[model samples]
Target: MEGERAGMKIGINTWAWVAPLTDEELARLAPRIKAWGFDAVELPIQAPGDWDPTVAAELLAGLDLAPAVCAGLLPEHDLLADDEQVVRLTEDFVRHCLRAASQVGADVVAGPLYAPAGRTWLLDADARRATTARLVDRLRPLAAEAAERGVTIALEPLNRFETSLLNTVEQALEVVDGIDGLGLALDTFHLNIEERDLPAAIRTAGDRLAHVQVCGNDRGVPGGDHLDWRAMLAALADIDYAGQLSIESFTAPALAVPMSVWRPLATGPDALAVEGLAFLRGLSAVPSAKNSRS
Candidate 1:
């Protein structure tokens, strides 16, 4: 991973192309993604039949591109609910996704797997505590299920606007405290909103950090916004984070409602991915002075 892509696996999520992606679409998209110099592509499995993992596996393999997965936890799929049936159905969904991830040869399935995106409600202190406990109880078995398939369920925490449940790295760490096969998927777009100190929060995630997503603070391409890429890159290096840094963003007309991505974020989706890739690849390209320069 050192030539054009250095010290990191730069990737783009298929959300940059289309949501609820289809095998037909990926069949056309995967090869172009490889030509763009992305080491991996973050495929989203929105539902059971949205795409076929085996088809995706063969397509990605033919192009020599690695594959990773992100799952959309829709409103109905609730692992943190007080109701047992909701939890049961949610666990089944997660297990199905883990199997899909394995079939696609993804080492981890990453996303805000705890609750549905953009679905939030207020919870008082007692309720919050109870909910977290319930979540841990529900997800422990799912974590084991993931391990059995040789994949990890990388839990992502969204902003308060999207989810009040686990908004910060500290909170995500607390929920995954005793879980054996669980990890965190840190996305810079959400971190820009909730975290006061991005670098410190990344360090706090430390080893439990399994995956990373990079984008502008405004959800534009990375390096085109005000985020401190220098410090963020340094922190990731300090923690020895080896997971793929997928460029996650949504296009218009497709995810406008769920993601609120109405306008065009860049000239086009490919432009965003290309610019971000160049910026990220340059993160460790230029070495600082005084290493042995005295």
Candidate 2:
């Protein structure tokens, strides 16, 4: 609510430029993002040594830009793991991520925090319910910690093949219901892959949605392909979900992540951020002009 713009606020995910970016590089890039009319920047706290949040905070403040923190959970970060040590380490890492997010002045710390990305397996009904229960138990404390830091923990749902746990907004809500300091972070990429109807699914998330990530079906610059972005934005408006619609995509040849996620997203990542900003702004402007006329 604090940083709402006329249209949906557009932002960029640093993962697009992660391989080539250092702390100083992001400092330089933050202002460029702000100048391009982006409302905020989503920084990935992929691992412990990826980037320094102190410097990131200073850079964002200097540019008068807002921040959103994305936590990257690896295979070892399993809340449902039988090993107590594994669960302890994962919870500790999540706490650190929340601290880093607060330090950077991010509104919310969003990611697939329920389990490690790409760590998937088959689950029976009882086992799946147990996993959901474990996730709730694991996240409740983290959610409290986030609230203490004045931030929210946004639980992102991945595709079916990626995780055995919650993979849709409806399922995410069911798991997070009555849990303090937890909300849904919807990604259009996942929605496009899994949802029966994109806009209808978005409306279902409704008031419980905390954050949004947008990209083309092929993970390219939005609007260059065939996504009904206008309808998407209109659905968001109908729900009064005033939050940043950050562009999240990965670049290839780096392979810093797992092999499954290393595929090329677009022709190039160089101009996707700027181009996406322009596209969303254009779509948002149309509604404003029409509203003025009426």
Candidate 3:
């Protein structure tokens, strides 16, 4: 944080250590996260009761660590599905997360909200268009809800394997085009897979980019794998996006197979967090165009 671009903050997700983070886990991990020099802690809301927002708010405020909120959508939370009940359920969950974020003093709730992860299917051009219309309609009201609570819905686009719709910045932009309270949350892992040029995609997102998630191309430690970290940071600088670069690698045992995380990225979660923080901090000391401008 010493030499970071003005207004830019770095964060790490609780998912990097645990899934469905509880208030107890947050209390335990937050001190270490602050000690490691993270500006914020990205908290996950896998369900409404996964954590207590009031407790989290107090703990974070006490440690001087900012709070961010991310969400996990199950198959039942698909907004584009044919079932009205399913759409209603999804809306309820998202609203709960937005309220939780507001309670925890987080300005944004970031995640793939249109459809559940791992829900993919074939779609003809005509069907795809129809689905897009449905998505926009469904999300408009939620965007309004987020705005009312002073929270932005940072919609994320997953890879082809995770979801069929909204796989690129262009697609996501289209959905959020006329929506005021909706913005994009780009993850480097998904960008590496779906984007032909990562930096260009970041530039395209521009001011609408609300949140950012970083990890190695292989879903490991940020700087321990093959990714152009400097270029990515530079593109962020070009956009003047003063958002948090939250690390979002997953390590929960139950998530290994579903997430396809077959190999260990570090000796343990602590090592991964510490190493990634060190590498990113080192970037701040290196002279670059962004640093020169600063």
Candidate 4:
């Protein structure tokens, strides 16, 4: 408490509500999200007008809640595609999302920002380096675009099955090397699958950790599964990561197929989100090696 960031805003992704999000859905969910003690809400940006930033911003402002952007880069929007058209389209989509993020008062446009989710392939050492080089080239001009919009593009590392590239913090850091206005979005679910030492990885990310998405290791409620939340919270405090800890689980129909959600992650999305909030709010009350000193 003495050393942690004074206020750590908690958020729930509208993925918990719906995917291919609509303006109507966001309008309806924002108030309820605000009522649930969330200081912020993360909206999924699928296209230029999928959800109007100006409208969402106004609604959140009325609710006294902050907004954050999560760029929905489906398989169709692959930045690392071999097809030139796909690559160009993906770049445009990212630029569009960056503008939307700016309009919605969010400084970070966050997502994998690479190939489609759940697509994996093998790559040799040379091919891996070449692919990384290609991503850096593609992202360079977009980084400039992001900077213009006062946005930082946070590259998230999905699990190995979801992606073959940038599945670890080290890999993501290398990809964003020499690129300004770019950072890493660490999802604890992915880290649970990929990192040997999750807290060490978080510490290693340190300042480059632009955004954090939290969930249970089993993709359930945060405290309902096996994750070292205490250590993770302390690592966040150590880095002074002044960003919202957004819960990023998916709903049953819209994202369940793609995200591999076979059954209910909770009684419902609201219960899952509410329970996680209670656990995090109680973090400071429980002393551990990570937070006892604080």
Candidate 5:
């Protein structure tokens, strides 16, 4: 039953259906997600106006569902930038996001919180290390603040094209090492693109992993396409990553965020969440059944 609880824990990222969700819609959606057998839901904190975390907490708690928060800071919100005001504003946002996560009962807050997504520039080796050092210094205070609220801040690495700073687990680990309350966040979509060996990368992340986000290679439903889900889950198990494996894919036919992730996946928004939960459940059962028979 211990393993059952760990393996059965699956979450859905709400941004895939953000277009169709208002505050009232989210209130309705929480119960529906619980009905679909999800253990939790992930809400993105882009700005103060993105969503109401207090209301979301009531809804999720009512349904006995867990919540996780993802940061959505922009380039102007850069913590490593030369501008002091930018760093201050970015820290404020991080603090707000952390408070929101606490209110929503989130155990972890994950995203590219070190710097802004889609903001990239070429950096020499020395400059990269310096930038990472700055990121650590800026994030340390915020990480401590989050720790007080019992929330782990997971730092994510985007693809090389998206950001030149941290493109792999090794880079993220180096950037986050010795940070008291920080951990790594892995996204399968980014993993499929950047990792030379996906399972090996997961193993590398190991105990440092604070959160996991799953989607197909094309950023769709987990099992609707050709991803090695078994291998990935096995690696997660090997690492003892006792965190929410949330499904995170964006909606298509309309570009919302400026990240340029416009790929059209085969599954619709609602179907993606429903099917992905089923797929994770199947994956979780296989090892437990084997262990039982053995």
Candidate 6:
């Protein structure tokens, strides 16, 4: 499968062209995604029943495209909310995501699982400690449940603008520490904004890294920005990360108002996916060349 996929298992998130990916959209995009040489498709679980897992499993199995799930946490689904009902609802939603991932043959459910995107609050030293304790209490059971379902909960650290809970690798590691089924999901976009050294952060994730999201610094096609892709990929190799590097840009209409992605990331979302895939393929060839010479 690695050879057939041109070295690494590259994927594109459905969010690149649509939000809350629908049954109709998945049917439309799955074939084109496979045709574009993506080895996998990342299905974003925005709401339960936005898309059917059984149908998606059948569709993706037929096309031979691997499936992955990205948990989309809305404002109403905050695990750390003061409202107990909100927290309960969040846990229920995540469990649904786990079941959905298992049904769709996805091993990892990746996203900002601690809080909703764009949810920020002042965290003083004492508050930070309290928050970490709260997070562990909230996530420990979910991690156990994920293990039962054969799915890993990959907790992603968003940028400061998007979140205040876990904005760095160290902070994220702290939250998931000692948890059996929890792992880190890193993104180049957030890394570019928050990390002092990109490759170092990737190395820091090491074996706990369950998933990776890649895109240009400006949220365009990767390799179209100034990020050092080769160095980052080398760090992944250093850590022996053999997983998918998913392209995760968003379409203007879907996330422009909130994400500030008013300008076109590429000629179109399709161009962004195709160009990012080509660039990643070129990078994957580098190690092959070195090995051939050796």
The lDDT per prediction is: 0.84, 0.78, 0.87, 0.83, 0.79, 0.87
In model 1, what lDDT does residue 166 have? 91
The weakest ten consecutive residues by lDDT in model 2 span 284-293
lDDT of 1 by residue, 160-229 (tens): 9989899999989988766777999999999999999998999899889888998998798888899988
TM-score of each: 0.93, 0.90, 0.95, 0.94, 0.91, 0.94
lDDT by residue for model 3 (1-294), tens: 332754767899988778768888888999999998899999998888989999999999999998889987986788887889988999999999999999999999999987878889888899888888889999999999999999999999999999888899999998988798999999999999999999899989988999999988888888888788877887887777887889888776666877788988667788778888888888853344556877
Model 2: lDDT to the true structure: 0.78
Clashes of each: 0, 0, 0, 0, 0, 0
Spell out the clash pairs found in candidate 1.
Answer: none
lDDT of 6 by residue, 228-291 (tens): 8877877776677777789998873777887788788899888888898998887652353223
Summarize candidate 5's per-residue lDDT along 78-152 as a digit string, tens digits.
888788998899888888888888988897889998677787898999988888888888888988998899988
Please identify model 5 stretches exceeding 4 Å from their true place.
Answer: 1-8, 19-22, 252-263, 284-294
Quantify how close model 6 is to the true structure by its C-alpha RMSD in Å: 2.8
Any runs in candidate 6 off by more than 4 Å, and if so which?
1-7, 284-294
Best by TM-score: 3
- Candidate 6 has a TM-score of 0.94
If ranked by lDDT, best first, what sequence of candidates would result? Answer: 6, 3, 1, 4, 5, 2
lDDT of model number 6: 0.87
Candidate 4 residue runs with Cα over 4 Å from true position: 1-6, 285-294
Better of 2 and 3 by TM-score: 3
